[model samples]
Target: MELLFVFLGGAIFGTIARYTLPHRDEHGSVLVPAIGAVVASVVWVALTWLGWAWDGGWIWWVSLGASVIAVVVADLAIGRHRVQTDAALLTKLTGSTATATAH
Candidate 1:
């Protein structure tokens, strides 16, 4: 199905985001790609519901583009938040401002 192609494209974009972004080690290998695929699926469905033709070229562009943007944003935000939270936890437990080592 065309949906499968969209999912695959989204996942590929997500994989790129995962490896290209910092703090990749903080999250599971599947997380970024999964997020991408899901976002792409959601976007595609939403567009279809809005009356966009499934066979339209623009639909695919928008869906996959949205997925890539979502993946990168989410990856960056989650990575930053995890680092901050981990550092805070470490500092609390150790009674020092010790930071986590970057991978």
Candidate 2:
């Protein structure tokens, strides 16, 4: 089915985008692909229900576009959270503690 193709394409695009991010190691392997598939599936279903036929090129375009966008936004949010968390941990651990000895 065309919907299947669109979902698969979206998954590939989304996964690539996520993995290509600067902080790819911060995320789990499945997170990007899973979210991509979900977003793509949801968009495909919604547009079809709204009368956009599966055969129409717009259906593929819209679904895949939404999936990519969702992945990008998710990456930004997750990356920012990781940065903040790391900064907080560092601050807590290095609280101006220093030792000095007079010779």
Candidate 3:
């Protein structure tokens, strides 16, 4: 019951976090949602150890907000790698030809 709720909460948090972020061509997929789920699971475990119970009230709201922040921060930090990888791919695809013409 509680475990199920935690997972559901995580899914919701991940979805919202993914929606809130800018549409990066690299991250415009299910990765953010998956990351969110992992983040939620970690938070749930920590909270459980701290004796926090989710009764679906203010505590839940706080936990949700925290989880969202965690997801956003993690995405921002880890997403740089994805962006760099995408940039490298783009550069490779475009080749070394430098176009002087303005778009």
Q: What is the TM-score of each candidate against the true structure?
A: 0.91, 0.82, 0.65
Candidate 3, superposed: residue stretches over 4 Å from native: 54-59, 77-80, 92-103
Q: Tell me the tens digit of each residue's lDDT in model 1 across 12-36.
A: 9999999999989989999999999
| lDDT tens digits by residue: candidate 2, 1-103 | 7767877887798789887876677778778877888899999999989999888888888899999999888877887898889877766777632411221
Model 1 segments beyond 4 Å from truth?
A: 98-103
Q: RMSD to the native, candidate 1?
A: 3.8
* Model 2 residue 55 CA deviation in Å: 0.2
lDDT of 3 by residue, 13-76 (tens): 7787777776434465667667666666677767777877666465566556667887788667
Worst 10 residues of 1 by lDDT: 94-103
Give me the runs in candidate 2 sitting further than 4 Å from their true place: 93-103
In model 3, what are the clashing residue pairs, if there are any? none
In terms of lDDT, model 1 sits at 0.92
| C-alpha lDDT values of all predictions | 0.92, 0.82, 0.68
Cα misplacement distance, residue 52 of candidate 3 (Å): 2.8
TM-score winner between candidates 1 and 2: 1
In model 1, which residue pairs have backbone atoms overlapping below 3 Å? none
